[model samples]
Target: MVKMLCDPVCPPPNLSQHPCCTVKCWKWDVNQITMNNLVKYGILILNRPITQNSGFIKNLWNRATIRMTVDGGTRQWDKFISGLSNEMQTTIKDPDLISGDFDSITDEILEKYKAKGCKVIHTPDQDRTDFTKAIMELNTHRKQTGLELSHIIAVAQTSGRFDQIVGNIQTLFLVKEELLLDPNTNVFLISDDSITWLLMPGDHVIYIPEETRQHKRAWCSLVPVGETCKYCTTTGLKWNLDNQSLRFGGIVSTSNTFDGSEKVTVKCSHTLMWSMRLPTIAIS
Candidate 1:
């Protein structure tokens, strides 16, 4: 049976040792993850404007073991906190690091954060996007600090330029190799209305919050990336896939809603990009 819990408890056990075991559990409720527990997650803000739920962002910032911004993301972060109340602003911590090619961030904002003792990493690689470069920095930071960050949450948006969105998704595919992170290190992209991540070829269980499962408009999708998912099966979705093929020109699961099940199960033959619509969360 799949283990499911609302609170951030212990890390999932190693089921790989059991040849018949292939289940991996996932939980996305950052708000419930407290600092009292092990700091196993990091947060990265991309250049896209953070127009998502402020309270949700606040929880992520407060609970993150490492916080960073990429290029113009510095300006975006500054703008985000500037709108918060003085009391709220005081609760948020300064970013631990700021990195980019230094093209988008203004000198004033850059200096301000530097004055706050944030590390500045100048990455001028024209081949990689700032987002990808930021992940490289994250890997370096992990080596220097010896912090075991098992998960990475990147704050970005999906409504911007289409190419930028696709580029962000492409970065997910390169995370393990470029960042030199563990194969199990999960990376997620959170936008104004959704959370997206890559699902490797395996069995997976995604625990949905009760509120989101009941939300009338909540949706989820699984799209094959890079190559077609030759064999994909799912449960707990309004339209479950039964040994179906998912490809760009073939049958793709989009705008699919939940079937009121608290958890969804997926078994796939190849890497698939999974995304779920976030419920309307109250801003603090």
Candidate 2:
């Protein structure tokens, strides 16, 4: 079983004296299959099959302040709910918005959601991927509605076509430049087996549960994306890096485990993709 920890306002005492401008804290409540105190967050379903357990996805969908689908994801969302019980289907409401080029979604599916009161947006800019365009639409929604969501959880799978998977990651890097999001806004990619997000150059405190740190099969990784990390340091990992470099074809931390600590700290000179395996939990 995975342990749950409350979100602390400040870093723990051990990390209090760390010489970093700002300390970004993270809690893996979603990965641990638990709900935290309701905060402003949105869900963005991509154009992929919803392979996650229905109940789990439903819980997230209901809790999300805003729900959206991109292109064929409208079909995917409809198919996901179609497999649920009548009670479950009724409880899971239609997406608040649907945006993407119409190339992938059929007219019938589009019309169904539109009639259900979903805001259908046609974004035909071929320069950006559907995923990227969807984020833009999400931002626009936030402004128009004054939602001010602090987090965006993108539900996607990592095992699909390699190019699409990489394209999704590229979108993470492009988010800051694409729009003026709050400096603290976080974008996460929730996969079936792992929770991944980009850690910009700064100090970060990621709270991992005690059970996960000690679990034999649980693992985490720090992959430098787009550029080489010149100075990277970490603590609470089985294989901690001490101001070492991490880059492709050189040194990257993959399949690394936690060092029996409830939290993992990372200090990197550049952006690094941090991913951790989800604890094995039986979904009803």
Candidate 3:
């Protein structure tokens, strides 16, 4: 008999002898929701300001295998790293690709990365934002040249202009069609304070990483995001839903805590945007 993904038990225990044993069952995409099942994806750093000491940046930098920058993002990165020690400055964090409309990336920033053997691509299309162009490039390469990318983690602040925030969310909707080749390609928008992602029209389970939920009261909110989400059911949230209809002006779930649960599951008719607070260090 074939053992199911959750056979034996949930979240395989890490053996002391083999530290990497914690990565068991990570290769299978259909495995039960767990932090060990996190898929490797290319990191897309946006132009938004991200300080060097940001926990979100620290986490992604260690996790992502590939890194790319969007337009003026290089400027933000350059400025951020410049404040570090000389040893850290000497250690290069060269991006594999820097893409945008060329309006945001300064000439100095481009020259600096170019000297470090970075591939700077100038997409002059005015029809789309640099954010959208980056996605298109990722999709194009995936289809034509077999660029291996499971998904994308976009690191841009939510404190930017309201229009910019909407535009970033729009990319999530547009990329849905392009990523149909892989159902596990979940794109997430992460920042210093929170993480936001779109849950499709099916059962969705979000595994909160151990490091992200320790001793922190995380508030999660669900929004339809430009559509009326109907008949949604959820478990493991403070305000659990049961076949509920949520709309922009009608009913939306906000300020809902996680109730100290490791996993939050939602089944919905329409795609709903899920936003959760980031666990942070308490500075007394």
Candidate 4:
């Protein structure tokens, strides 16, 4: 068993320092998850090299060191690779790495990132998407860098095969508690304090930022596998729901706006997923 020595100011000597005390066993009774953890390192993982439409490419231009993994898809590989060149030039300025099996990836694009000295490793695992492998690689990098894995803004995680999307999200639930990821694991979002992960069946409050401010988009959500949420209560959205029961077939909250300015709270009788977006910032 791992032991922790905690002082108010400094952490224990020679002990692993997690971004939050939640990773380690804490003696203090914390009421709920908050947004305080967003201030630290924010890691973004993109599954498959970006497919840049004119609009999507422009939006991703500002992000730094985007580690991308290309997938082996049934789509037209040549056309995808040819179209990506110009967009890669326009949107990606950082040393973005491209990795995955070469089945769907072209020789031209592989040479491009490689020539630029971006680290590339080809792991042709048939059991998982290249995306899943990339996430594991990022986890290893996180441990090596001594940074806790944060919000992963993954593209193509859901847009690919329907089964793949479900599988990727399912992996989120299996993540060890110490890893501490946002509820929507495959999305590019984060919280300032802490993201509330689901529990079995009980009443719990999730802290959220109130909407009445400058930002119009403040909230987002994901349904857990099987989507068996019996009931949920939220206090931050523009439309408040009390004792509302939601399931797989019902309304799945994807893009919900916030109403308050400071923080909103959520209570659920069953396990539920809720996440807030964070501004894109660079980490060293």
Candidate 5:
């Protein structure tokens, strides 16, 4: 039983902090079957990594109902087709929506997708990142249908300008803030080997599915990104947090090993991020 000493400004401590809360159980009210599975979520493929990726990319391709591309990501989609055989190319699905500042995507690709019944919405707002625009689109669509998205898997390569990579991380938090009241909305940054997502304030349990494990050990991390997470605790992790405060320039949980723990639980005083090394299995 992990007890919490809550910050005054933060809500009253979750009395139901795992083994002993009387008010509410600290468990997420989501179906265990869909937890960490991509089919239940949405996929937003950005240009870089998805464009340069193959094989492993085939694994997570068709799991989401909502599919969209960001800016040059459309160009990347068309480029991806170039690398596939005629049979493989026919199986590729164009995004339902292509959104961005209309800079990187080629006119040819736009014509192609539009011809295939895809909607292309161009926003000339240079004020925000294309990633942000894409997120806004998702938020709006979900709100209209009153459908809560299971999660978001953002596919983008970090092999770019230093600031761009940092901006991508910022995109995660920014979208969370935009959908401020929706606590269940999850956004994940995924590349080839790394996956990351924010663990908002309160209790969080990361369920390790059997399919996500390819070896005996996998690595996971928790870092206080926006503000310091005070009085945080975790279990089912090799180096468990014992009422620790995580922040930069201070103690942080990084490269922690997840050695066959079926469930990892975490509770924080404020919003923070949870990152982990994704399994390398080819999920066909």
Candidate 6:
């Protein structure tokens, strides 16, 4: 029987006995990690067919193998299909598959991909987000084909409405660990830019790459979501805090940075959050 790894990611029971297990890299702040070594796989999830976002699709096509469209707020199936731009029309017609509720996908586009052997699955579980649905579908397809994907390039995942952006961010929390197993998954809110996620309990080194810009300076934050905290320490930032504990009303690591490569290490029971600005359409 093939060995199957289980959820709740952890190390092998007997490290010495097993002798061959994926090394678990620990980090606190994952700021400067690169996509240097990893199997790269791509999946595109569009809320609706693209019309004017041809540049986005072209960029995604450069990385992704399978493309998926999910039904969202727009409910007009025929209109949505007919309204797609020529480029989007071509992509949808030639994608690996189309999986989503048929509420918004027009008959024209649907028939086109289906005729080309695109497997369409109509999933209408309101409780589960469409983002989750597409991911589950991708995982299933990956298993069926015996293809191992390193990362997923999720396009147009953020945007549409305020609530959706929030839901999408929450979705990051849900899929963070699952993505770590594969090459690596990038969830783009919109355009070619992306939102990367990280967790706590390890030490991390972060820095802006030379390719991004001649000089990179932006705010870095460590937000403690859901609750307050106590004690915080950081380095390589304008405002340095050591042995300093923060609470709901206390100091938070917001809008802080240093001259050259900024390095940060922290020990926190809460999730420390950070965001930095980069050049347009930066994918690394």
Highest-scoring model, lDDT: 1
For lDDT, candidate 2 versus 3, the one ahead is: 2
- The C-alpha TM-scores of every prediction are 0.87, 0.87, 0.80, 0.54, 0.79, 0.64
Clashing pairs in model 1, backbone N/Cα/C closer than 3 A: none
How big is the positional error of residue 56 in model 6, measured in Å on the Cα after superposition? 7.2
Give per-residue CA lDDT, model 4, range 1-284, as digits (tens).
Answer: 11111111221211234334232211211111111222222333344334434233333333322444444421222233456567564554433445567676567766766776767777688776565666666666556667543245444433556776566555444443334333223223222222223332333333333321235444456454454666766665677667777677776666676665344445444445654443222110
Please list the C-alpha lDDT of all candidates, in the order they appear: 0.79, 0.78, 0.67, 0.43, 0.67, 0.50
Q: After superposition, how far is residue 101 of candidate 1 from its true place, in Å?
A: 0.8
The sequence of per-residue lDDT tens digits that candidate 3 reaches over residues 1-284 is 21222122122121333344332122212211122233356778898887424433544554665678889888887777776678766654678788998787779889989999988888999887888888777666566756556557787877869899999998887766444324445567866667787766656666654544554566779999877987899877878999999997888999787666677778777778888765542111
- Against the correct fold, how does model 4 do in TM-score? 0.54
TM-score of 6: 0.64
Q: List model 5 lDDT by residue over 1-284, tens digit each.
A: 12111111222222234334222123432222223233456778887745323555544555566788888988876777687888877776768888998888778878988999988888789878888888888777778778656567678865787777788888877765655324455667776666676666677766665544435557778889878888788888888998899889999888787656676788777777777655543222
Provide the global lDDT of candidate 1 against the true structure: 0.79
Compared to the true structure, candidate 1 yields what TM-score? 0.87
User: Where in model 4 is the C-alpha error above 4 Å?
Assistant: 1-66, 72-92, 145-149, 157-161, 176-222, 249-262, 275-284
Off by over 4 Å in 1: 1-38, 177-179, 280-284
Model 3 alpha-carbon miss at residue 53, Å: 4.0
lDDT of 6 by residue, 46-158 (tens): 56433333343454454456655555322222344456677766554345656666666577667766787867777788776777777777778877887766456554533
Model 4, 218: alpha-carbon shift in Å? Answer: 9.5
The parts of candidate 2 lying over 4 Å away from their true place are: 1-33, 36-38, 280-284
lDDT (0-100) at residue 157 of candidate 1?
A: 89
